[model samples]
Target: MIDSHIHADTRPFEDFELMAVSGIEGALTCAHDPLEMTSFDVVMAHFRRLLTVDPERAARNGLKLHIALGIHPRAIPHDPERVIEKLPDLLRNPSVVAVGEVGLESGSEIEMDVFKVQLKVADELGYPVIVHTPRRRKAEITSQIMDLIDGTMDESMVVIEHVNRDVLPELVETECMLGLTVQPEKLTPEGAVEILREYGTDRFVLNSDMSSAPSDPLSVPRTVQRMKMEGFSRRDIRQVSDGNIRDLLKISQI
Candidate 1:
């Protein structure tokens, strides 16, 4: 199964072991908070290293790892263009899949500006994007993004992550795929099943989002198990567990 949205770079060795045992065939490791590092060159270097190191690490554990290269909104640099300037070169690398984990967090003007700029870049380059919606005022933030990308960005090329109950209806109105983070404190395995039951698995995909959270690496596989127990058919479960992610990766060419 493919976990569509995982910060595998932030995950540990044991987590990889757990993922392998839990039947995770592949995962997309996204660029997350870079902590104290501030230089664009320095940040780009770190992401480049990730492009190299993560695949080798995943191969050793018998897993396939793909990369998504973009500055997270909270970690957007003082000069976001400096990072945006480097995306084309990064996208040329075969391992790099999408442009994202980029979007508004505080819903601040600066955040929206940077997010729109990156969205333009992704649209220009013909790469899919993985957007991070705000934890608070999610509906407002999503609306803001939709407005910014209304003409330039294609909804089919975006995956809105960290989605929950309140924002699902509005987000589904767009053609973008929906990502649910299966964390202990957030959406449980049962909760994810309930969503699948209500929405079916067509535009829906499941993720662990285990980075810095109280979520387990095997959450996706566990969710699959729970869905089966809850009477989701194999074909339907595969749509949510693997098919939807595989289709998105194909669109991103990674």
Candidate 2:
């Protein structure tokens, strides 16, 4: 299973720790382009300025760590374009998977502008967008994104993050996939179940979304277990596990 979103802000456990603990094959390590990776150095076992993970390290640990480039919302105020301009090169690497953790937020004016620029970049580069929709404006921001991508993107070319309650119908109508973070946070497990019931496990996906939160690393396994206990079918559980995520990321399973 792949954690569609994650931040490597820790030092004691590197990015693969999630897969190691979950007994899953891999996870996507969201490397924030704007934050000081050093500030959160204490959590990871080690910090490498790796845009794409080192295969040797990942193989040694029995996991695959896929990295993506994005400047998260909080760090958007920094010269985001300066940081963003480097993304295409990062995406050029065979291991770099996608182009976000991008999109609008009502957090700040800088956040909005920076997100706009990043959205445009993600559109231009043709990498799948990992969007964090605006607070309380899921419909509004999502509508705008739909309009923006209507003519340009293939509709399946973006991934909407479930940072909060999803506007599931709107997300589905937009022909995009929803990324549900099923980490160990309170309310997350239950919340994910609800979305799965509403959207089902196909277009919906499960991610750890773990960065600074005390959420469990084995979030996907926990999700799979809880989902089954909640009466979700094996096929549905498999969708949350790797089917939907691998499809959205276009990773080959065979």
Candidate 3:
């Protein structure tokens, strides 16, 4: 299991064959705000279909897709620095990892100057970022996205996704990486296992931001069968449904 946020190009290839028959091997699929960003070649043809047509339609319906390109502060276009100078040659595409569904929905000022220029281009290309936090003044826009990711980048390479429980006690004492997005309007596989039993699964990551709204493509294998009917360990449900997002996107094992 690894859904650390999904879109699979707005769902439907039978929901990646029902999220690979409900055991969901892998997924990432980020880059958002597409109902026309309107230029920079329509956001570089939607980041070249999330690097070539949504990883060949999630590997022909057996899942294992992964990619994360940026620009999603409500899909800002009209020359977002030419898609931030073409995101380091398409994030050195080896099925691109992160820079993500970037941050701040309406903390405007050009969405905080395009989320501080894509978090300074994912901290000058070291990569790993997925920061989206908005559902109307979510803890004051996540404290202005943790003050533009305080001192810029390396809050353990960022991940602050669609979290809840009113910003989980200030993002569980930040060092980033916490996504918990089960969707329906977010957070409800028993409120993402009650924020992993009151925020214990350190650096939590579990997702199904499966877009085109009203989602639940087997929301991370039905929240891993509700963390196995709430008895929770199996190494804490394999570290939030797959080893803290495959060790925060260093994803090696296929």
Best by lDDT: 3
lDDT of 1 by residue, 1-254 (tens): 88888776666767777788789888888887857447686677768767987678777888888888888878877767888887888888888888878887887888888888888888988888898887788888888877877887998989999888888888778899899888887889898888888887899888998787677788899999998888889999988888887887773322
Task: Give the residue spans of candidate 2 off by over 4 A.
Answer: 14-18, 33-48, 52-58, 107-109, 134-152, 163-166, 184-186
Per-residue lDDT for 4-96 in model 3, tens only?
A: 888788887888888888888888999888677967888888888888887888888878888898888888887888888878888987889
Candidate 2 lDDT over 69-187, as tens digits, reads 66666445334555666666667877777776766655456666666666667778777877776556667766665665566556687777754554665667667887777755434
Segments in model 1 whose C-alpha atoms lie over 4 Å from true places:
251-254
For candidate 3, report its TM-score. 0.36
lDDT of 1 at 103: 83
Answer with 1 or 3, whichever has the higher TM-score.
1
Candidates 1 and 2 compared: the better one by TM-score is: 1
Tell me the lDDT of model 3 at 161. Answer: 90
- What TM-score does candidate 1 reach? 0.95
Cα RMSD (angstroms) for every candidate in the order listed: 1.9, 4.4, 14.1
lDDT of the candidates, in the order given: 0.82, 0.65, 0.85
Question: What local lDDT does model 3 show for residue 74?
Answer: 86
